[model samples]
Target: MADNHLGEFLRARRAALRPDEVGMVAYGVRRVAGLRREEVAVLAGVNADYYARLEQGRERRPSAQVLDALGRALRLDADAQAHLHRLAGTAPALPLGHTTDRVSPALRRLLDGHPGSPAYVVNRTLDVLAANALAETLHSPFEELDNLARMTFLDPAGRLFYTRWNWTAQAVVGHLREAAGHDPDSPRLGELVRTLSAHSADFTRLWNTHTVRGKTQEAKHFLHPDVGPLTLTYLALDVRDSPGQQLVVYQADPTGPDAEALTLLGALTRSAAL
Candidate 1:
């Protein structure tokens, strides 16, 4: 029998893909993205009816061979492929509570070691599990905010912090959507959503968009109260043996106000400790 959460995950992934992007053409009117039932079936070398049944949540269990074929057909990367397996119930399900990754000592050292760079450690949910002095100084905490998603959605300060507020908020929601697939039953995640949705209408709006994105290198702009607007590039590196932990590092853009602001933020951090 198909589980509700499993069906939701499959539906979310199905919607994330598009026809043109997946090398498929409807040749007529279509109601959905990516390959249609027939197209996906053809690509996966399976019967159309079987694929339809699988999509409809009538077939919950698929063999590893079938999942592998479907993954290729979908052009899924390793993380996305794992998400597909979890959705199909081939992988063991986890509790959707607020399961979090512990900040490793080495990771803490890594963040502290990068005193000049704005560095923080985040779990799959984009929770700011910890931050070094530089990151803490750069982004103001709102209502005692530490979580990235919370700040992006709930904090007025964070709204001011993000130069492009709308886009930044949407990106956080999109990132959370991607993380949800990695672990659906985590109560901690459920609580986080409940808190933000209750407080921020914007969060609720973006969450409904159903967008998803993997953690990758990207640029961010922040309007710091102390130093003005600063742009930075960020990248997340996966932590070994930690399924959800990733260390995110941010560096100032070499040109423009970001460079000046970064130097100022660094000085602010050093002076504060003096």
Candidate 2:
């Protein structure tokens, strides 16, 4: 089947929007949930047929102005708008194929430096390439910390570990969506999505939303079995040497209870090793 990511994205965004949200008044019984094709065309200042064609995959090349107009019509945020451009071929897509999963030694050393903090590296697909001692200990509850998405939805411990599972799930899907924009043709990503969709209804729901996000910076709350509750702020930085790898560092204030919990967690890890 011909992949129509652009069309799927447009349709998903359109269905997610409401007429009243865009200052459009409903005239009659609408068959669909969101604005009609004609309505979007009117708002975007493009011909209705042209808009329809774009959504139907008939019109592959859309000008930047038209894309900008469509973005406005869909109420796309900066990330979603960038995704739209990438889908439309207006922006440079990310490097294709599987990005190297190996973490460089220097990067490993950086992760080691954060003994008090939990630091790990993940690829674009959210695979845990490498993690420091504290980082591994933080996610030790999971059966496997290989892939964040899989562990989140597939693993039973995911729900128990993450205090805010819904928010975390949304962020995971958004990150995957952003990755999709980069490599729409990636088989590895395709298989992951397929497996996730097959097994996880929540994954299916959020995947359909077509929301785009990256694992940039966020505060994560975890309920560790050994250490109790922990709230940590994490920063995700893209590794300059590796195209798709990201170094994520989780930190808690030294004076805070969360930091104490982290300390205990680290001690527990050491005890287990011993």
Best by lDDT: 2
Candidate 1 Cα misplacement greater than 4 A, ranges? 13-45, 68-79, 89-100, 201-210, 254-257
Return the TM-score for each candidate structure: 0.77, 0.96
- Cα lDDT tens digits, model 1, 84-162, are 7765668775454434567878888988998999888788777788899998888754665468898777766877778
For 20-54, candidate 2 gives per-residue lDDT tens digits of 99999988988988989999999999999999988
Model 2 residue 145 distance off true place after TM-score fit, in angstroms: 0.8
Whole-model lDDT, model 2:
0.89
